[model samples]
Target: MIAAKRILRKAQRQLACRKRKIAIEEIMESKGDPTTFYKLVRQQRSSTSMGTEFLTLNGKTAESIEEVTQTWAQYFQQLATPTAESTYDDLHLGKIQDDINLINQICNSSHQDDIPTITKDEIHTAIYKLNNSKAADIFGITAEHFKLAGPSLITALHCVYNRFIKNQKIPESIKRGILTPIYKKGAPDNPGNYRGITVTPVILKTFEHIIRQRHQIILEETQSRLQTGFTKGTSPLVSARPTYRVHNRI
Candidate 1:
């Protein structure tokens, strides 16, 4: 019995040594590339916290992986789908005749000439601006991949965007998103504790960036001076500075 226990302890020690060697090798490789280091760290953190094994559904615990996945699907479906009894009442304002007229005038105004076609420079700018460490969408393409791709790839993407703009339609691939549920501050077992964050394709984001550029011009022309948030070169701090000065004067 003593001999057998000694052999088991020796095997356990050998296994632990092997694991430590592998971990050391990974760390050494990651040190050469900061991006790889960040990715490895993120994966390690996600593996520990993100698990579907302990999910609760309909007052019962899911036993299998498939059951847990299905439960999450059902939960999201129910949350997205509106109940038959759900209704919205028409909103009425008693004294907003001029406000309504101004809104109608702005909505009816034509601004076709302001819209610009997608250009290679814009695509390149957008690609470089994309975050490298973000999770990829369902297509398994990351922004870092695009950033490394040569100018030819940017040109190709520009052409694709122009084609999409000409058709006045976005492809289904662009519209598709992967929903990842992130746990908030609550019980781990409860589905309500999690919030779904949609990860969109990097290519779609490039197109959005081009569109935003055109929209920004129109917004600058039409948007009220009081509205500073989400505009270029203006933030909440910039908007609050004038208000702070006024308050101090009073």
Candidate 2:
């Protein structure tokens, strides 16, 4: 399986250092009581993502168990949907809104969706109102001047925000699947419009030596080395769900 193979490679990288010697006593200790041997097997699987939590008296070594389980769990956790509140920033929001306005106009939504067929005058008025709280000053006909659009603005806003939210999730998956893979394959003859793939070091190195090689701080590899100590084989050792949140008023 792809998951199993990925696990084996990772485990091989990590355990490369710990392959000194194992006495018969230690090997026998692993086999003595079926219960004890079983515990070690579970322990081996417990630290990885492969779902090998409990098993029969299995193979000579349990290399792939931990890595596969850990990787799969990580994949799912990254699959989590981000909340709208913490997901977008002011620049992103503004660009989204701008694009949406243009889209609505193109779709004839402004006319068909019952939104006032906004002229240059109305747009100017709204811009002034948006710029300052003096909405009444902008709109000459001002009783209790509060701008209201029909279905078009509402639909456009919702759709644009939805897309912006999706965009945040896109880069990572692209890096993991498409972008990183292309980078690893090397600079194409026509590297047209390729948003640089610096996501994975192994992939990124094909382009340039951006970060240090053979550093002790390789997060995934280091985490794998310390995985058994950090987790109950549930999730990766996370710091915290990103502490940064946009403070801008929507």
Candidate 3:
């Protein structure tokens, strides 16, 4: 019995060594690709605290992987679907009403003819601005696909964009995105503890970049100087500077 236990322990040690070697090789191979490298690192960890397993909802326990997935889908769907009882009666009004009116007036008075049409050059520029190593949308399309596409594809996109602009309508496909639930905190089994991150199509993002680029001047002029969050080349830490000074004075 003692001899048998010794042999089993030796076998387990050998298996662990093999796994360690394999993991090292994979990490080395993925060194150049930051996305894959981080993913591999995550896999090497013993366990994750964020439980994606929908063990139970209400009183019913999920029996299979499919059931768990379905439960998550239903939970997110219900959250997205607005209640029939919902109304704008709970909202409050102040000077915001005047601001809304001003925006509406500007939009109504804007001339469609004065707006410049989408061009191939603009499409190329937008495509170039896309970031690398992002999650694909529902269609399995990534930013890399657009970045590597030739001039012919750029011309095609240019035409499609202009057509949408001329008709004042966007295709339904462009608006679709895939939502991934990321665990935040609290009970892992509870869907309420997770927030969603939507993966939008690269093409749709490129089009948005084009629109933003066209209105860059206006946005820069109208944007508040004190705002730091989400603004390019500005850090959220900048907003903390004033708070830090106030704390020191106090």
Candidate 4:
């Protein structure tokens, strides 16, 4: 009777495992549908409990949910806030004189050529090229919002970009960003295990895209051959060929 009972328990466990496998298979099959995929993921997560309820705070374990929440808040606040002892003068601006001089030379040279004006077509292209899946900024503006706004929004953005360029100023709206903490591989409760990523407005991204296009054109003409990373029509493999040949000869 005991052996029969054990067999029945083993069969029940196998049936449960089979059901879970089928559910996972269904989720994999529905990957094309993002909504369904995310829903399944949420359901899966809800079924499991995170083992970490307490967090280490200042060498002490936070026992309650309130304590954990407070500890996290304090951790983030301290991480974000600058130290009182640190001063701007302590940065030693003179150390970067050579870099500053080189940047000034580049700027002066670039200015000698006529500055490219922002266009509606460029703005439209930048907006349309933006990925819809990207996170929204503080204002909750996404690429999809701009795409739906159509030609009127594109024209307005073009005007704004040109105006900012002429005035030599950036708008406060563009300057502000939403910082989100992404968990990296480490202890779940450790604040150091997370990295903050800033999400800027899509409109600012569009403007940046236009500027980047112009900057790339200038870089292609003036950039050194030794600086190959992030350059178009070139790869690290192509850059390494010269070094590889030199090593072979040696």
Candidate 5:
């Protein structure tokens, strides 16, 4: 009877494992359904907990919730802290000063018309381009909020953005963002194993979108064709094709 029970338990475990494999295979085989694949992957994870409960810092394990939170905060704060700028020799420093003076002269000589003002249409286009269902920033505002906002809000944004450009200033609140630590493979307690993903306010993102759209053509023109990374219409393959041809000729 004991042997029979052991055999039955083994069969049941095997059956469960087969079912899991079949489910994953089905999810993978389904075309154009990344959502289902990600759902299945998430479900398979042992823990989806975002809590820093198991975190360790400075050779000490954090015990309480507050301590864990503080540890995470300290870790991220250290990462965000700017490093000291490298000192340049007198000759290099003088050359940098000359470049700065030239830039200042150019800016002073340029007309106000050179800087384009923000328009309501640009704001509308930016809002439409924003992706929905994203995590909110420190202000608890998401892309969906901007998308669903009325025309009056667009006009208001246009006014505010124009003011920002005119005065060359932006609100500190807009600069603030929320950092979420996502775990990468490693010891769960190690802070270095996680990468911080920053979410900024939707308004700021909208403004940036408009700026990028306005300057994209000029920026793309200025960039070299060799710059495949982060550039549109060019990828690793596009860069490699030339090298492959050269190798073939050789």
Candidate 6:
């Protein structure tokens, strides 16, 4: 259930980013000026957040991911006005509906068999692999980077992801509710901090290679703050300090 939420939230960001990028390109094609670009940035927040899931940043915000998603969907429905006359020709409308149908089958279903299983990590590994293996040059940014999960998966997901973003960035509205795993910051013996990790290309490629050959993606267990700062004095019962990563590959 938790993994499902991550998949949903990440999906929103990924989809919204693509839409935003395309919109920017359309605006640029008209030679829109600096003012237009500034306006674009200002409105970018709404575009990204609207009809999309968001991790609540503060306490006052509602904690329910489902409520937030429903709110977004309602906003989109209200905003997407129907036209009496078809703006899209029959052929175009058909294609659009087809695409929507395909995505719906893949993403929107309660039955496991009905919906194709596409995991966030699997998607990340696919995009990262593609990027390293020539797709990045073609697309500029890898899909994982485009999706903005690389940093979180590597360093912060184990900790920085508050209860909100960790498992429920994307809430599954139709299927069910969201569940957050207990955030583990390590024990008293292994308290620590993670200096931001600079992911090496080799490691990134390793992820791609693993996925390519094994048909599975493995996110290496990252050393987080919990592992580093643990002190024996904090826990008198332990004979040794808790295991922690001082540096690479602990």
Supply every candidate's count of residue pairs whose N, Cα or C atoms clash at under 3 angstroms.
0, 7, 0, 0, 0, 10
TM values, all candidates: 0.65, 0.18, 0.66, 0.62, 0.69, 0.21
What are the lDDT scores of the predictions, listed in order? 0.71, 0.35, 0.74, 0.70, 0.74, 0.40
lDDT of candidate 3 at residue 64, scale 0 to 100 = 65
Q: Taking the tens digit of each residue's C-alpha lDDT, what string does model 5 give over 1-250?
A: 9999989866764565455456545645653675564354444432443344457888988857788778989988888795545774768778988999999999778766678888888899999998765565678787878877789789899889999888777899789886666554456578997666667788899999998998887877797878888887768778798889999999
Candidate 2 deviant stretches above 4 angstroms: 1-11, 15-80, 84-88, 104-250
Question: lDDT at 177 for candidate 5?
Answer: 81
Could you give candidate 3's per-residue lDDT for residues 1-250 as a string of tens digits?
9999989866764565455456656766887997896465545432442224344676776746699778877888888896645554434444667789998898678776767898888999999998777666678888889988889889899889888787667899888887655544455557777667677888889999999997876768899998788888898899898989999999
The stretch of ten residues in a row with the least summed lDDT in candidate 5 is 43-52
Q: Which of the predicted structures, 3 or 5, would earn the higher TM-score when compared with the native?
A: 5
The TM-score of predicted model 5 comes to 0.69
Q: Lowest summed-lDDT stretch of 10 residues in model 2?
A: 178-187
Instruction: Tell me, by TM-score, which candidate is best.
Output: 5
lDDT of 6: 0.40
Off by over 4 Å in 6: 1-84, 109-250
lDDT of 5 at 222: 93
Q: Candidate 1: which pairs clash? A: none
Candidate 6 residue lDDT tens string, 1-250: 9999989877876776566456545545534464464344334334342222342322233226676545434433444576556566888778988999998886454444432333445444544554322123122333345345555554432232232223333323322212111112222111121011112233244334433544321212443334333332234334234433333346
Point out where model 3 deviates above 4 Å: 1-51, 58-60, 84-89, 92-111, 224-229, 235-250
Candidate 1 lDDT tens digits, 8-83 = 8667645644553454356457767867754644453354533544578789887476887788889999999956
Q: List candidate 4 stretches off by more than 4 Å.
A: 1-114
Q: Residue 87 in candidate 4 has what lDDT?
A: 52
Candidate 6, residue 86: lDDT = 54
**What tens digits encode model 2's per-residue C-alpha lDDT throughout 146-182?**
2344345435534533343344222332234212101
1 versus 2: better lDDT goes to: 1
